[model samples]
Target: MKQRAITGLFFIIVMIGSNLLGSYVFSVFYLLLSLFCLLEFYKLVKQGGMQPERFTGALAGVTLFFFFAANCYFPAYKYIILLPILLSFIPIGELYKKSEAPFTNIGFTYLGLLMAVVPFMFFHAMAFTRGDGVFNFHVPLGFLIMLWSNDTGAYLVGSKFGRNKLFERHSPKKSWEGFIGGILICAFAAYILSNFYTEYNRFDWIIMSLIISNFGTMGDLVESMFKRSLNVKDSGGILPGHGGLLDRFDGLLMAAPIVYAYLYLISN
Candidate 1:
């Protein structure tokens, strides 16, 4: 318990510091982290007895990362979307040659890319577009704070008063009490932050908070499903108490795109 707490604090500090730095640096860091995560995911796929082309998959993953980075840094790069379609054939070819269940490999690989890379691109895009500093630091940091508030609230409340399960099969430890607590805390954070923003109204920020918190929880569950399927405890041992990069950003993975879309749709 003591180790976990210390690890958690250290993780938070590093994350907060990185987010404060802004978009280009954040995107660069994201690209590198995503590469590591992609490596871990590919390792999992290989372990599942699927013969996915590792080099091809890694290349495709890196391509996907840059494509997303382009989506943020250069919106005019419409050709970026086509990259996925083109690379989709690599997995498809592997699926075609399989004597057994080829589709599973192809599907898992594709889904992994979507689950891991696409939303992160959206996050990068959001970070770049929303702020006006060296790296558009404020938007990403605000988003992180919102996510952290939700996570902290859920942990504190769920540990104390949780009884009803949110989804026992996927995440046995989470409860409805914790879920609501997290949402309320996130909503409060949103309200508080809204006062500083002239662009979004109180209701808008609150809605964004709810979307982030709820989907973030679901995202964590989704990652849990992957880990459970692989029969592993944590995704990786990158963070001391936090498990892997994937484990730390599972919520952000889903929440980032949602927040980006919210800003894109409503604010724009």
Candidate 2:
């Protein structure tokens, strides 16, 4: 418990610091994080008897992140097309290797991209598009705020009020009551954030928070299911008591891209 508390505090500080440091630091820091999460995903998949092209996949994930980030800032970097060309190495390299389940390896390679890469790219994109070309910490910071609030609220509410299991097969501890409590808490947080941010109104922030809460729960469940299939308790021990990058950021994985879409829709 001490370890968990310490790790969580440290992570929160670094996250806040990164946001304050502006776009470059945030992008570089999270790109490294994306790479770590991608590597962790490969490690977990390997334990499940598939040999994903970790190097190629990590490279591709990293490149894809930079590709979108560059496109966001430059808006003229046609080099973005090079990402798919780079990812082609996954299958092309697999063809040369002597593996019984080459296609399975290839599948996991792309799965890493879908699960971790693109969402991170979406997050990077969000950090840049605040309408002034300056780094807007609100979108990404608000995301963290919403995500953390949901986790905290769900835990507190579920421990006292949990009765019906949300998904007993995948996550027995999760409850529908907890989920509802989380959404309410996130909506409340969004309302508070709206006062401070003011770029987006209260209702939009609440809607964004709702999207994060709903999809964030799905992300957690999906990671839980992924681990169940792999027969692992935690993703990795990289963060001491917090499991791994994938475990910590699972909410962001599914939530980021969809939230990006929602924000785009409302903005337009």
Candidate 3:
């Protein structure tokens, strides 16, 4: 328990610190994070007997992130068009590997990018969502706060009063009671943030909370389904009690893109 607490504290510090530092720190921090997480995903896929192009996939994912970062920073640069061209090499390179499941390899490689990289790119872009290329930490920080609130609420509420299974097939431990509790708590966090970030009204925060709670839970279930399919226990043991980067950021994987879209639509 102590180890878990320490690790969790350090994790939050690093995450929040990078965000508070500035755009450069945030970009570099998440870029490396996305890369490592992508590598971890490929490792798990390989463990499942599929040969994903780890090197090419990681490189593609990192390059895709850089494209997004550069676009966010420069906005006037036309360099983003190179991403698709780079991604096309994944399959072309796979032709030489002589793997029996060449298509499977290519598919999982792209899946890794989708699952591990793209969502984070959206998240990092949230810092510059205003179209001014100026970075603000409020949205990203609020997003994290709400996510943490949901997790904490779900765990406490579910552990104590959970009766009905939320998804017994994939995650038997999850409960509908816990799910509701999470949303309520997450909504409360958003409400609090609304007071400080008066730029967006309370309604926007509430809506984002709902998105994060529901989709974040879905992400957790999806990861659980994935690990179950592989007959694995945890994604990885990098964190003392938290499993891995994928396990920690699984919620962000599904929630960030949707929230970014919401923010973008409303901002424009």
**Which portions of model 2 show Cα errors greater than 4 Å?**
none
The TM-score that candidate 2 achieves is 0.97
lDDT of 3 by residue, 139-217 (tens): 9989999999999999999999999999999999999999999999999999999999876899999999999999999
Q: Is candidate 1 or candidate 2 better by lDDT?
A: 2
Q: Which candidate tops lDDT?
A: 3
Give the per-residue lDDT of model 2 (tens digit) for 38-146. 9999999999999999999988998888877766666746787787789888999998899999999999999998997777888877776654456788889999999
Best by TM-score: 3
Clash count, one per candidate: 1, 0, 0
Backbone clashes in candidate 2 total 0
Q: Any idea what lDDT model 1 has?
A: 0.77
Candidates' C-alpha lDDT: 0.77, 0.88, 0.92
- Which candidate do you rate higher for TM-score, 1 or 2? 2
Better of 2 and 3 by TM-score: 3
Model 3: lDDT to the true structure: 0.92
Query: For each candidate, what TM-score against the reference?
Result: 0.87, 0.97, 0.98
